[model samples]
Target: MFIQSFLLLLAISFLSAGRVPRPEERIIGGQNIEIEQAPWQVSLQVNGEHICGGSIYSNDIIITAAHCLYEKERRLEAKDFLIRVGSSLWNSKGTLVKVAAIRSHENYNSTNFTKDIAVMRLSEPLNFTDKVKNIPLAERNPAPGTVAMVSGWGATSIYPKHSYPVHLQGVDVPILTVDQFSISAGSNGQTACYRDSGGPLVVAQQLVGVVSSGYKYCDGPTQFISVSDERSWLLNAIASIKL
Candidate 1:
C-alpha cells in the first residue's frame, strides 16, 4: 500500500509539477503579457474564497493539485470548490463553474508530495472566449532544456513580511533533466508553492506540463510537472470522467 501510494503521488506530482526551485535570475520584462489570452488559465476557489490556481483542459474539466483539496484531517468534496476561468485577477467577475466531481489519482499520497494531480468536473460547460480557451496537449515527448513558461498568482519575493502579488505572475524557464531536478529538489521536496499548482507550462504553443510545485523562496527557476510524460494516463482519466 505504501508503494502504491507513493507511485500514485508521483503520478500526481508528474501531473501537477510540484517542487520547483527558484532560479537565480528574476523575470521582470514581461509583466504586461495578458493572462486573459490563455484559455486554460483558471482560479481555484474554496468556500467562495480564491486560494489556489488551476487550468481548464476541456470545456467541463479542470486540473489542479491534490494537496489543494486535502486538509490535514479531512478531504475536500467537489461541492466545496469552484473554478473561475478567464480571469486575470481573482476579484474579477467571470464565469463561475461549480465542481461536480473530483477524481484524484488512486496512488496519491498527499504527505509524500507524489502523484499530486486531481481533476475537477464542472457542473456546467464553460463558454469559450478569447480570455478562455483550451490549451492543446503535447503528444510528443519533451526533452530536457526545453524552454517553457509558468504563470501564477504566487508571491513575487520571499520575505516574511512581503506581500503576495494580487495579479498573475509569469516566468520563462528551461526544463532540466529529471535526474538533475530530483537531486536539486531533495528527496522529500516535491511540490510547487501556493497558487501555482495546475497552471499550464506552454512550450511552442503546446501544453507540455502543468505547474505543480516549486520553492517558496522565489529565488530560483521554477519546476513544473511534465505533461508529455503522462499523456496516456491523462487521456485515460479524462475519458473515464467524460463517459
Candidate 2:
C-alpha cells in the first residue's frame, strides 16, 4: 500500500510539473536590489546550481520551504546541498557554505501543501556582516491589507520569453490572508516559475511567509506557508539543534 501510494504521488508530481508550479516560483515586475538590503536572503544550491531561495535565521541556521528539500521525486540529504549568502547574484559573488543538517516539519503534507517549512543547519557558523544578517520570525499573522516584500533569483516570468535573472529581484505585494498574497494586481500579469521557491516574504522586518507553491498559471493568488501558523513546530526545529 505504501509503495502504491508513493508511485501515485510521483505520477501526480510529474503530471503537474509543467502546469502547477510549486509555491511561489517567480517575481514579476520586480526591480534589482543589492544583497545588503535583504541580508537574510540565501540561495540553496546543488552542484553550483541555484535550486531555491532561503533565509538566514541565525549564525548557522537557514529557513526555507519543506518541499525545497526535495529535487523532483527524490529526497535530498543535508550534504547534497550548499548555501550561498550575501550575494546579489545567485551563482556568484557570495559565501557558499556547507549544510550540516536539515529538519523539515513533521506534518508537512505535499498533497495539499500544508505545514511547508524546513530549517538547515550550517556546518560552520556564518560570519555576520553588513551584507549578511538574519531576519526575525513573525509572532502573529499580518492583517489582510499589509504590504510585504519578496526577493529571489527565480525566473522573472513563466512564458518562453522570460529568463532567470542573475541578480536578485524584489517586488512589493499586499497580503491577502494568513497564507495568501496578491500577485494578481501590480505584478503586471507576471507569475512565478522555477528556482524561486522557499524564499522569504517579509513584512515589517519580520519573516511572515515562505514561498511554497503556485498555480498552473496566473489564474489566482499565490500561496505561501504562514510562519506564524507553524510557529510551534518552527521554534522547536530551531531550538532542537545544539549548534
Candidate 3:
C-alpha cells in the first residue's frame, strides 16, 4: 500500500513542477482559529493577493519558503511584495508591511526543493502588541512523533479556489520521522498543502519548520525545510542583513 501511494505521489510531484502552490492546495481538514492565537503568523501576498503563509521571526525579519519568492526568475524589489501581520484572516485588516529585501538560501534547489528557505526584511520595525509578536526559533529538532501545530490561511478543501478564509485555520499534526516523511504523499487532513507553502511548523510555540511543498491537491504527506537543520544559515542571514 505504501509503495502504491508513493508512486502516485511521485507522478503528482512531477506534474506540479516548480514549487508554486496551486489554489487547490489548502487546509484539508483543519479548524478555524482565534484572531490572536498566533501572533507571529503573517500572510505573504504578491500584487495584493494572498499567496503564501509566513511567520515573523523578529521585529523586522520574517521566515518563509524560498519558493515563495523564487517561483519567478526575475529579482524581486521590496515594492513588489507586501506582508500582512496581526490578523487572523489574510485579507482582513492588519498591519501591512512592505518588504525591504528578500534573501533565499544560496543552495536552494527548486527541482527537489532542497534548502527551500528564505527570510524577508521588513521595510520598518513592527510595533509589538498582543496581536503582533515574533515567535522563538527552535534550537533543536523535536523527537520523532512529537505533535506539532501548523497554522495558515490556505483553502479549506481540495476543490476549486475556496474563497480565502476570513479567519486563520490551524491543525495539530504529529511529526513523522524523516524516513517516513520522505516517502509520504500529499497532505492528508492534518498536513500542510499548497496554500501553506512558507507557513511555519511549530512545536511548543518555537518555529521548527517552514512549509516547502505538498501534494498536488491536498492529502497524505507534506515536506518542510527543517529550521533546526538550517539554524546556522538562518542566523548568518539575520546577522548579515542590516536593518
TM-score of each: 0.77, 0.84, 0.84
What ranges in model 3 sit over 4 Å off?
1-26, 71-75, 160-163, 179-187
lDDT to native, each model: 0.59, 0.73, 0.73
Looking at model 2, residue 98 earns an lDDT score of 97
lDDT of 2 by residue, 1-243 (tens): 011122244344424444543234347657799998799999999877888889888999999887788766778899999999989988888798999999998878888557778999999999999999999989887887778888888767655444678899887877765533212222323433356678888888998888766544432345678877777877788889544
Residue range with the least summed lDDT across 10 consecutive positions in model 3? 1-10
Cα lDDT tens digits, model 3, 139-243, are 787776788878888767645544456678888777776541121222455666556778888888899888776665555667777887888999899887764
lDDT per residue (tens digit) for residues 29-141 in model 1: 12424666565778787766666677778889887666667644467788888787777776576677788888877765565455656778889998888888877777764
Give candidate 2 regions above 4 Å deviation: 1-26, 179-192
Decide which is better by lDDT, 1 or 2: 2
Winner by lDDT between candidate 3 and candidate 1: 3
Question: How many steric overlaps are in each model, in order?
Answer: 31, 6, 8
Looking at model 2, which ten-residue stretch has the lowest summed lDDT?
A: 1-10
C-alpha lDDT of candidate 2 relative to the true structure: 0.73
Query: What TM-score does structure 3 among the candidates reach?
Result: 0.84
